[model samples]
Target: MDLYITEKPSVAEALAKYFNSTGANFKKEKNCYKDTKKNIFITWAVGHLLYQNPPEAYNPEWKNWKLDTLPMIPTIFKKTPYAAKKEQYKAVISLIKDATTIINVGDPDREGQVLIDELLPANKKVKRLLLNALDETSIRKALDDIKDNKAFSGLYAAGDCRSEIDWLLGMNLTRFFSLKAREGGYTTVMSVGRVKAPTLALIVNREAEITGFKTQKYYNIFAHLKINGVTVKASFVGDRITAKSEAEKIVTASKSSELKVTDVFKKSNKQEIKELYSLDTLQIDADKYFGLSADDTLKTIQKLYESKYLSYPRSDCKYLPTSQFTDSPNLIIAFNEAQLLDVKIPLPNLRPPVFNDAKVSAHHAIVPTGKIPDLSTLSKNEKDLYLLVLKKYASIFFPVYEYESHKVILTNGKYDFTFTTKITVNSGWTALYKNMPVSDDAEHEQDNEVEISTAVKAGTAYRVETFELKDAETKPPRRYTEGSLIKAMNNIKGDTKESNNILSKIKGIGTPATRATIIKELIAGEQLSKKGKTLIPTEKGKNLIAILPEIITKADYTANMEILLDQLEAGKIPKQKIITEVTDFLNTIIKQKDSLKIVNKDFPCPTCRKGFLMIKYYKDPDTNTVIEYAKCNNAECNQITPAKNNKPKIITCPVCKKGFMISKKNSKTKNIFYACSCYPDCKTVLSEDDFNKKRG
Candidate 1:
């Protein structure tokens, strides 16, 4: 009797139906699918079957973050039994005890491998069935080729190494920073983590660029050209054009010159539709076009996958595996019949994207379950996300859009100017994306030599209807859209030298299954905010990085750690060594705290003009207490203040001879108060009129 264990019930349910296990009796609490025929029991674990606990679990004082207990290193890490859904874990346990041979069916990724590795019953006959798609065909195929769990020993090691490294680096550094901040009298929650710090660092850097940006003015020459009575506006070239006098002279000469055909050159180019929708690509498109947050996009995609309307939503590859290609056609037909196209642009074609097994590493790119969704049944967001998937699916079978590209050159006084244009020949896959506006393409159609109607020679002069000097400004870096940030995270080349090492070895920023969660964590932590789909770093996030260690803030550092972890999982390296090395590295960063100096320009201490006000504590919104406090840098000054207990207090002139006392909330309703510390001495109370008084 054989038993299959998946990661989630959603997947198990889908797989059970495909297997047509008529005698299988389903149980939710025990999370088992008992098949009477084969006498097999299948169960699943929701995410991690076990997790790492704090060092204090073994040594009590270590649980509480204390500076004296710096570099709390744990040898021979212990795992605790933890299940977010306890009932599911119970069912899994029950199934595990009864199964003869267990087949693991987690996501075919590094993390997934670790998830299953920790859950199998001790000393049991366990086989790994790595299948990316939960479809009946893929599952049945995986069952036929089930591999020994020993084959993934290296992968399991890597996952273990990654967790340990994060623990060593994150827990130690976060504690070190917190203590350093406390000693310095700044009460901010100084934190650092392998991925969290680097990710936070990205947002912080972006914020700095935006805040410090300086705009510069530039000039350019624009002209309207009339060729065969059709008008086209010329794109801006550099102002001054090196030969401004020549340009002006030519403009004067062209005002009265007869229009003539100039030399025309043409070349054909094909606009290939993007490779099928990788989870990253799909999330990106949804963010750009539909303004969906990366997290939201993943959630929506997951629902679609669970509904059997799409394949796995956590895949990184956009190409289908050669093995899965056999089932692609039927999936396409199912999608069409399901009318998934009812809400989106009509399907361009039903063919699957090109299958390149080399590119299909862990999982094939996201595609339809071949079951089109019922538009009326889905929410607005589900519909929008479905549309994106539908279009991507259709694009694979559609022919590439073909265009005739043209380059026209004009010369005046030995100064030559060139214009490029593309004339659409066939809509092809672009038909699905055509209704969308040309967001960044600024040149007008009339200015382009689209399907040039005139056969103009290069030497022939053309009349310029009008000319003007256009003013322009050097633009600062645009704020990060969820689409762009995801790209940055996935950047292989990396934006900084330190990050390059990590980028070189790592395939992408983070795994597809975890990327969305990382983004959500940042948002939840208030390190970033979503102004629509644009992720902007908040002040708190910026301050955190400004005072964090260089090692933790470097994205490449995180990437390098990830690679090492991967190596560990692959059995290329020992987990203990990686953990030890990381733990030591973090301790070194802590020892160099004198180098990091945090400055607050406006946050000044109320007691002393020389001291800056520092945030001391963090309290839950619903329950407020004296959670934390920051102190002034000057120890002699001894400037310290307690955080407001819940909501701020409003009192009448305790000291004020006139006027009233008042308190106000910040943009997010945090807290602020205005009162005289000289309550008994000066008795000066705060006044609404005085508050309303403008300050520069």
Candidate 2:
């Protein structure tokens, strides 16, 4: 019997439907679909059914976090059943045991390779099917190219090492710093991560910069030259001038001397279509244009991909393979038939840069699979994102954006000024994106005021007609928006020409597949606060960074670690090589147990997600005894529950399975009663005695 293991249930359905199309009969069961005639079974694992075991699972002594057990190093990581998804694990395992041959239908990535490989028993016949898209054509293509599972051992090793290292460092470092913080008279427990720490640091450091920044006044000297009866305002770019007196000197000097056009340069340039969407780039664009959170944007991408409106939403590669050109004509025809664009697109015989250079990864870039869903049924955001990807793909067929850039260098022997302008030869590929939410073109922003006439002859003499001094204040760095933050995460090295030349080889902090998740995790752990569209670190987040070692906070350090992960994936180095490097680096920070520090922030209320814990001292003057307990800041949820296992005690409503049972005082009797957190909605109430009895 043959078994097919897919990544998720939706994929199994797609596969089952494809086989059914060929007149293969299938009987849908509880956990799997079976085609008895062909002796084929299709099953799925819900994301993942097994997770890495906790520290206590390895050693009992490592369970309790203390300074003595500062670094609980584990030589080998183990995987145990995730309690919530154990049934699926058992189902997959049971099927694997029964089958003679197993086909691994995981996503085409390192993580996906490891996910299915970990489930199979040794010596079983396993073939790999790298499924990029669920569309009929793609599924058929992937099915035809099945290879042996062992061919991806390095990819699996890289993925395993990534998880093990994360568990080792995340668990150990979080314990070490949290223990140190406990000694500092704080009840705060720091939740640290390998990627989360550096991401939080970015926010905290940016906030500090903004808070401490001081505005500085600066002066600009302008030399307006009159030539050919046209007056052109040119800023003096002779030399660095900060002082008002110095700017005055340049204005005076240029006023007394005749200015001549020393050089006139004109160059034609093309703004090619922006590259196709990588998952990270798509998230960035979605956030920039629609204020969608990274997590939400990713969900939308998945929805579109699963619906067959997109190819693969989690791709890291920007380039596509030449074979993807087979569907372009149909996709263009679909676009024109749907009336998506004003100008009807011809046959997509045009093979553009998307297929050129071909830096393809596990899958090609996210492109349409020549399928368009019913537009009216889609939500506004979904419709917007779907079209965004569709238009980006369509842009490749448009003409190259052509423009002429003109530069005029005016000099008075001692000082100089410059003017520049652009003449749009053709709108080209960008014509499709007019009034679109795409970012301003970099070349367009680099140019100055563009009213100058490029037809003027060079070396023409002109009088320095007028001089003006403009005052400006230097601006501080802006806060990181969700989009801008993702952009920064993609390139840890600065974006300037200077930094590009210096740090061009440096990799990003995280992969396109993991960057959004990192941001989402940081926000969920309360290390990052979202205000409007900007990201700000909370007080607790700031203190966590302060307590962390300088090496952990540096983006370049994390970026370099990514490069090592890549090297490990390529089988260039042993897994232990990267593990030892990370462990050694972690040990140095762990040794700083004595020096670490963090300020205590108000702890969240145990019951309600929105409230915080506040202490109230009830004093009896005669005995000098005070009844002290933390009260919730929220008036609605006034549950004064004791702490259990370091987290707030949760006494849930037995009837509705809502949140913790908040207490209410009976006005007549002065007795307490309990009600569900969803009180008005769920009118299940109980007396204090009844609640205590039920708890017991």
Candidate 3:
């Protein structure tokens, strides 16, 4: 019997349909679909049925976070079936045992490769089915060109190393920090991981920069002059003046009311068309235009791919393979027929920028699969995102934007002033976005572009009508939005000696598929937050960074690890060597754990006056909702109270007269409200002011 295993049931179903083309039907069983005529047994795993064992699984003593049991490094790593997916794992194992040959039909990525590779029996003949798209044509093509399973051994190694390394670091550090924080009277679990730590550090560092920023008041002198019956606004050569006295001096010196144009410069420039959309760039643009978060953009695009309207969405490559260029005309024809494109301009000739095989990695750039779907069937967000992908596809075929820039320098009695203007000679690709709102950054970039008098010439003198002083203050750096954070993560370069060589060759801090997940985890762990598009670090997050060593918080550390993973994938280094190095590093850090200090801030427990309060997180098993709270230190008197932002106040509930009111914040919406302390019983909620007034 020939066995076919897929990453998901949907994919298995899709593949089963093709094999059941004959009159001989497919019998749906408890765990698999059997095609009797073709002698094929098709089954699927719900992502990964197996995962790395936690520290507790290695040894019972490692279950509790203790200083003496720090750095629980298992001499031999092990895998266990996810409790929720054990049935699926057993089904796959049973099918593998019965089959003469097994086919691995997983996603075309390192994680996907490892997910199936770990489950296979050494004696069975294994083959790989590399399906790029779920469409019938792509799937059939891949079926006809299956390769030996051994071909993906390197990818399996890379994925295995990544999982083990992450498990080792996450389990050890999370335990170490959580235990250490107990000394400071902070009882909440201080979770830390290889990727998550550096990612959180990025937010915390940005928050520091924002908080430390000092606003400085400054002034700029502007001159309104008339030249050839036209009014033009010019600014002093040295723009900002720190002192009002200096600005006043410029105004006083300009009392002559005459200015001479010392020099005029004009030049034409063109902005090259942007490259095609990689996952990161696509997420950034979608966030900029449609206000979609990085996760939302990724989810929507992934849906589009599964729906066969687009190719694989998790690609990091921005350039397409040269062979794909040959198929571009057909794709363009399909796009046009779908009425997806709004551009009326003629498509330009195929250029090298759009197709370069050298730059193509595991996957090519994301583009339309030339498979059009019913427009009405897609949701508003899906339609918007699909259109975004289509526009970027169309953009490459449009002419570059061309404009002429003009600059003029004028001289007053003792100072020189300057003016500039830009004339659009051609809209080019920019015409596609003529209807959209100008981006905030684009508007700022063009702030200096003003209307200029055509008659103005070099060495010509004109009368200055008046001098106006504009007051401005320095603004701090803007907080990271999900989009900008994605960009930052992608651009983070290693500057530390330990990571410089490794990280310099790595493209970004995280892969295209994992960056959104990293951000999502940070938010889930209460280490980071989202206010609209802006990402903010929570008090817990700030505290975690405050206590964490520089090595863990630095991007270089994670970047170096990623480079090693990449090297593992490329077969440059053995997995054991990397594991050994990581183990030694873990041991070194574990020894120094004693030297780390945590500031104790425990307060006497209000609920149980005999005990002090320590931070803790509680999850409602029914809802799977996690809430951080303060708990009494005494084991016998286990009284709990909400923590930090949601900590209860002295106010009495108006609705539930017997209970006190506590502030409760919605995790997703970030809205604050007051609820009765006796939740699930006296479920009373009030406005912040109302609660405060009631307390008063």
Better of 1 and 2 by lDDT: 2
**How high is each candidate's TM-score?**
0.82, 0.75, 0.78
Per-model tally of clashing residue pairs: 35, 0, 0
**Superposed model 3: Cα runs more than 4 Å off:** 1-46, 82-95, 102-109, 127-148, 225-232, 255-260, 337-342, 371-378, 412-414, 442-444, 451-466, 496-501, 562-574, 592-595, 600-696
- lDDT (tens digit, per residue) of candidate 1 on 1-696: 677888877677777776665445544334566667567666777778678887888689897878777777876777876746666666677677777888888777678788887777578888888776655566677778889988887887787677777777767877877676655444445556667777777777877888899977655555567665666555443344444565566556545433333545878898776578888888777876777788889999899888878787887878876566666566656666665553323333343445675566667778776566678899988987877777777777777788777777664443345566566778777777766534331322354344544444556677667765555566667777777777777874555665586675565556667777877877876668888656887765776787776766766676667666766766677777777677677677767766665554435554556876555556667787445444555566655443343111223354453433433335585645455554456555444445334210
- What is candidate 3's CA lDDT for residue 528? 87
Most lDDT-accurate candidate:
3
Instruction: Report the backbone clash tally of model 1.
Output: 35
Residues 1-696, candidate 2: write the lDDT tens digits: 999999888789989999899798877999999998789999999877789998888889988887787677787888997899999999999999999999998877877888898898888999999876555776788788889988888888878888888887789888887777665424556788767777787788889999999988888777776655566777787545679998887777666677788888988898887479888788878887788888888888788888878876777767776666776787788788898766665565557877743366666688776677788999988888887887788888888888887787888888878887666887777767776775632333542456444465687878777788988777778888777787887666533454343334433566676778888777776678889988999876888888787767766555455567778878898988988888888788877766665435466764666766544445768799764445665779765753332344457788888666777788999788877777688888888788777655
Best by TM-score: 1
Q: What is model 1's C-alpha RMSD?
A: 6.4
Please report the TM-score between candidate 3 and the true structure.
Answer: 0.78
CA lDDT of every candidate: 0.67, 0.76, 0.79
Ten-residue segment with the worst summed lDDT in candidate 3? 439-448
